[model samples]
Target: MSVSIIKCNSYRECRAGIDKALSLIGGIEKFVHPGDKVVIKPNLVSKKRPDSAVTTNERFVHEVIKITEAAGGVVTIAESPGGPYSAVLLKSLYRTCGMERAAEGTAAALNYDTGFTEVSYHTGHTLKSMPIIDPVLEADVIINLPKLKTHAMTSYTGAVKNLFGVIPGTHKAELHFRLNDRAAFCSMLVDLCERVKPTLNIMDAIIGMEGDGPTSGMDRHIGLVLASASPYELDLAASAVIGYAPNEVPTVREAIKRGYSPKDAAKLDVMGESIEKVRIPDFVKPESHFNLLKLIDLPPALNALVVEKLASRPKIEYDKCVSCGECARCCPPEAISMASGRPVIDKSKCIRCFCCQELCPKSAVRIKRSLLNRFMVNFLK
Candidate 1:
C-alpha cells in the first residue's frame, strides 16, 4: 500500500496538494464513481475554529468535496462530534468550523441526521456490534478526513481514531466505559476502522495540534497533507511525522499487531516528501502520556497498580470553569457530578478516559500527574 505525503504550507495550497496526493494514489476516480453516495467524515471534535487546529480544516475538506463531485460522486459531509449529537449542535459546529463556508457554492451537503443504525462486526476483537451514524451506514463510499493531533487518552489521533466519530452521540462514552483498558479501547478503534473501511483516507497536517490535544493544545505548522487507501498505513505515516514511533500510538500498534500495517514505516511506499524531510523530532507529546509506565514490563495486576499512581488524571480548573456541568454530563463512568453549580469528580469511579477533559467547552479540565510521576518522567528523560 502507498501513502501520499504532499507538502502543503497553507490552506490556500490545499486544492493543489490534495489533488496531487490523490493523483499519486491513482486519483479520486479510482475510489469515486459517477452517482455514488459519498460520505466525507471530517473531525469536528468540538466547536473550535479551523485555525485552532482542533478540527479538520474546512478548506482542506472543501477540496476533497470538489474533487469527488467533479468525478460525478454525490458528496456529503458528516461527523458526530463529542457530546450529545443533535441537529442544533451539528449546525453550530458546521458554522464554527467553517464547513458552511467550504460548501457555500459547492453541491456538497452537510448531514444533520442524528439517527443511527445497529451494525454487527463479528471480526472485531473488542466490539461485536454497535451503532453507527446513518449517513455513514447509507454511504456508497466513505472518505475519511481526519485532523492530526496528539490525544490525552489514546496518545495519537489520526485515521483510526477519527472513525470513533461514527458511533453517534454519547455511545462513544459507553465504549470508553466498557473498555477502560488502553489496549482494548484502541483495539476497538481498529475494529471500527475495519468495519467502516473508508475508501480513501486524507489528513489535515498543514497546521496540526501538539501537546495535550484533539481539543486543548498549541497549533504547530507541520506543512503537509497525507492520503492513503489504508487507514492503518496512513496513521503509521502521520504519527511518525510528529515524532511518535509506531508502537507509541495505541491504534497504530494494534494495527501492526493485527497485520493490517507494516510494523516499520520505512518499509511502506511513501510518495511526495520523504518522512525524514518533514519529520518534526521535537514535537511535544501530551504531558499526560509522558510517564514511563508503558515501558515497564510488569505483570498485569502490578502494572495497573503502578499506572494508577503514575497515569495522568483529570483536574478541574475551578478558576477557568464556568460551572457548565458539561464535564459531568459527558463523563463515561459517571465519575463526575455537578454539585452546587460546580462539577466534582469521583476519583474512585474514574476510568481515566478523559472524556470530561476532551468535551469540556471552557477548557477547564486539565491533566494532572502526581509529583512522584513527574519526577520519574523528568529523571528518565
Candidate 2:
C-alpha cells in the first residue's frame, strides 16, 4: 500500500487536500459502503482549541463527514479523552475542540456512549486483550484521523499511536500501569494496530504539536494532509517529515521488528507531495526522549539505577495548578494525590507515563528531570 502526502497549508484548504489525497488512493468510496457504520477516530485528547494543536482540526472532520455522507456511509465521530470519561466531559471537550460545531450542521454525530467491550486481541504479543471503546467495536468501518505530534512518553505520536485512544477511560491507566516499560507498551500498541486495523488511516498534520506533546506543545505549520491504508506506513512518512528516525518511534520500531513494516521506507509507494519537498529539518522533539536505555540490555541492578537516577518525573506547579484533582484521578500508577487543595506527586510510585501531564488542562504538570538526566541529555545531544 502507498502513502499519500498532500500539501494543505491551512485548514481552509483541508477539504481540497483531503479530496485529492483520497482520489489518489481509489477514493473514499473504495472503503466505505452504503449503510456502513463508519467511525471517525480523531485525536481528541483533551478540551483544547484546535489552534493549540492538541486535537484534530474540526473543519477537516466536517469535510470528511461530508465525503462519507456522499459515499452513503453513516459517520459518527468517536474519541475517549485522557481524563475521566463521561458524557458531560466528552460533550465539553467536543464543544471546546470545535467537533460539536462540526457535528452541528453535518450528518456526523459525536459519540456519547461510554460503554466498553473486552476485546481479545491475540496478536501474538504480550498484550492479548484490551477493552476497546464500544462505538469502535460496533462500527463496520473505522477511519483513523490522527494528529501529528511529539509525545514526551513515546517520542512520536502518529497514526499507530493514535489508536491507543480506543482503550476507553481509566482502563488506559490499567495498560500503562501493567505494561510500565516503554518497549512493552509500544509492543502492545503495535499488537493493537494488528488487532483493530482501521479500514483507512488519515492524518491531520496541517498544524502539528511539537516539543513535549500529545498536549502542551508549540504549534508547527506542517502544511500537509496524509492518507494510507496502513497506519504504520503513514507514520513512517510522518516521522521522517518531522526529523525523527522512523525506528526512534516505538510503534514503528516494534512494527519493523514484527515484520509488519518495511525497514527501508524507500520501498513505500509514495504519492502526492514528495517527502523531500515537505520535510522539516529542525522540527522540535520532546526534551526528555532519553529512551536509549531501553535498547541496551543492562543488568537488573544497573537497570534499576539507570531508571531511578536518570528518569524524568512529573512535578506539580502550585502556582499554576487549579487543584482540580485531574492528575490524581488520571494517574496510571496512582502516584499523584490532592492534599489541601494542591496536587502532590509521589515520585517513588510514579511510573512516568505522563498521563497526568497529558491530561492536565492547566499545563501545570511539568517534567522534572534529575541532574544526571539533564547532563546526560545535553551530552547526548
Candidate 2 per-residue lDDT, tens place, 1-381, comes to 889999999999899999998998889999899999999999988889877889999998889889988999999999997767799989898989999887767788889999998888665497778888999999999999999999989999988899998888788888899999888999888888787889999899999988878797788999999999889999888898898776688888888888777885666788998888888989988765776644268888787877678887788888898899988998888887787668888778988889988999999987777888887777766
Residue 146's C-alpha lDDT in candidate 1?
A: 90
Runs in model 1 with CA error above 4 Å? 291-296
Q: Quick one: best TM-score, which candidate?
A: 1
Model 2 RMSD to the real structure?
Answer: 1.7
Segments in model 2 whose C-alpha atoms lie over 4 Å from true places? 291-300
Q: Measured by TM-score, how close is model 2 to the native structure?
A: 0.95
**lDDT (10s digit) by residue, model 1, range 159-249:** 9999999999889989999999898999999999989999999999999999889798789999999999999999999999998888788
